[model samples]
Target: MDAKSSATDAKPAAVDAKTAAAVAAAEAAGPSTGESVRIDSWIWSVRLVKTRSIGATACRGGHVRVNGERVKPAYAVRVGDEVRLRHEGRERVVVVKRLIRKRVGAPVAVQCYIDNSPPPPPRETVAAAGIRDRGTGRPTKRDRREMERLRGLGAGPGGPSGGGFAAQGRPGDRDPSGGRGRPNGR
Candidate 1:
């Protein structure tokens, strides 16, 4: 009865109207496979990408290809079209088996395309790569030496010098007080 309650009730009606209109339009268009859909929308609908925005960004960045050629986001996708998407350092190759305008579940999404991507590369262990987790404190002298050795620096294995630093040590290593406290004087 209140204005706020009335407004809330009106909102759902508006949303329902919009949904009905969309359904009608889709019905008029007939089967999706018979009509071409935007490449970005198709990618998102088929779950090839996380979202339509990401698909659009990928297309704009030249990371999306259609039939072996780079294509814009608005490119029309039809049945049997080859779509190759390069994302996160990996390439996904899929051929359109069905066209869908709305996103579906993963199981259904998989049936929309024929995936031909290669197996992902083996994962490297953090310890093997000498990668330390954050907030673990700075590396110790031994850790530093090991890191430099892995990087082919220092005298551990491949380095020509004693270590990453010069043989005489750094400038900070010099006595700031001119060695006045020492018994020997030049």
Candidate 2:
């Protein structure tokens, strides 16, 4: 091998070892706040939604927490940790099964961790969620009547709520009916 190529390869190999050691040291530093994970990356990896940015927003909005304590994106999660969260209205609980460092599909994310999402909220809570009956098995006649009432009282053309109640776009889509929105706005 040429001397220049040999020297270049040798340098990178040493750098790799140094990087690995640094990582090990960092891991051993111990989280003063207890078991935690990167709020943004882990949420993305867990398929909780779709992207890191969304996860970060969730953390900021108080939707994600570690061991009952709200955490920021910098939190470092460890195994067997418990996390509390709220998506729409009802609270959820999740137990970390493993540490995931990379983004994964929804199915794979499910396999990576254990989520103890709270059972379906009471009928009243469901009604307050604004969204139509979710996983409510089958809508009974009474629910149908309430839905009709809600629709009639709504401001939207057919009875839909404001923009806040609308569905969110996925990670990389564009917003519709707007000049400015998120990438997943579509």
Candidate 3:
């Protein structure tokens, strides 16, 4: 009909042709597992790390390992390889189940790897243990002494009760020379 309508019709045909070509090429290439992807790219693709650059940084920092050996960012990764990443004070171990080049959604990304990480430590035990109230502010001198006593560092049972000259009494309170403050009867 109109020129605009004809142009739109031609665009879809071109896109379809490209899609068909891509599918045919993929079929010809056979299984995806036969090809290896870069470790940094794979890590980012599977959501193991936030960004490809971060993954590369981690690799360079010696925080990434493949099959128990540290590997560089450009290292090739294949299916069935075990990857260990140390991040945020915890270690994550995963087995690669699929290889993907582009980053994917969380669900699909998770499907690409088999997580073998140990369970994270309980939050209460880590962050809440001995935690004081919000408005408590800094500890007072008495609180410090009590805490030291609890840790067996203060003068208490099971700890060294005061040490040196201070343990007895003040200099004027007790005569260290054994004159009883009379100063040799003078």
Candidate 4:
């Protein structure tokens, strides 16, 4: 055989060997039954949880469920299974689209599941309702009262009976004698 032809023949054999090795590796790492993967592994592999340990912890804490039933970390998860994970104060609902045992990049991870979470609340409506300006110092009595009123916790304009402090004598109105000392002879 000419030198060029011999080199070309060797290339095909090398490619075939690489392909066989890949196939063996995939089979060894894939699910034993080729139908389902462990829930914790799947969650971590798909990037639903930051780590496998966290995914397992969530499962143990009852923060993860499959098809409305709480499942253990080693529970088998098959395609089309609905997984609900409650983490970081939010619930993520996703349907398994594919089974993955190894962690993948964000793009591939996203493809393994279909997210069904609700849209987050708007920023304006969810901002801290009682946030105060920085370096403003403590709120004045007037400001505190206004905040209480806004929260419907303060007495009304009619005084304490009406839900306000007006009826109660102010510090200045109190007698120095410690008694209801009539300042002007009540």
Best by TM-score: 1
Task: List the pairs of residues colliding in candidate 4.
Answer: 155-163, 155-164, 156-162, 156-163
Task: Please provide, for model 2 over 80-153, each residue's C-alpha lDDT reduced to its tens digit, 9 standing for 90 to 100.
Answer: 78878676666767887756666644544565568788686677744453466558776675675566557665
Model 2: lDDT of residue 41: 78
Model 4 per-residue lDDT tens digits across residues 51-77? 999999999999999999999999999
Stretches of candidate 3 exceeding 4 Å from the true structure: 1-35, 127-130, 148-186
TM-score of each: 0.62, 0.46, 0.55, 0.59
In candidate 4 the C-alpha lDDT for residue 122 amounts to: 68
Q: After superposition, how far is residue 63 of candidate 1 from its true place, in Å?
A: 1.5
The candidate 3 region of ten consecutive residues with least summed lDDT is 22-31
**Model 4 stretches with alpha carbons more than 4 Å out:** 1-36, 152-168, 175-186
Ranking by TM-score: 1, 4, 3, 2
lDDT of 1 by residue, 53-150 (tens): 99999999999999999999999988899999999888999998877788766656676789999987777622465789999899998888888778
- Per-residue lDDT tens digits of candidate 3, residues 52-137? 99999999999999998999999999879999999877799999887778776665666678999999877777533235578999
lDDT of each: 0.80, 0.67, 0.78, 0.82
- As a TM-score, model 3 comes out at 0.55
Clashing pairs in 1: none
Which residue pairs of candidate 3 clash?
Answer: none
Q: What lDDT score is found at residue 80 in candidate 4?
A: 93
Any residue pairs clashing in model 2, and if so which?
A: 36-76, 36-77, 37-75, 37-76, 37-77, 173-183, 174-185, 174-186, 175-185, 175-186
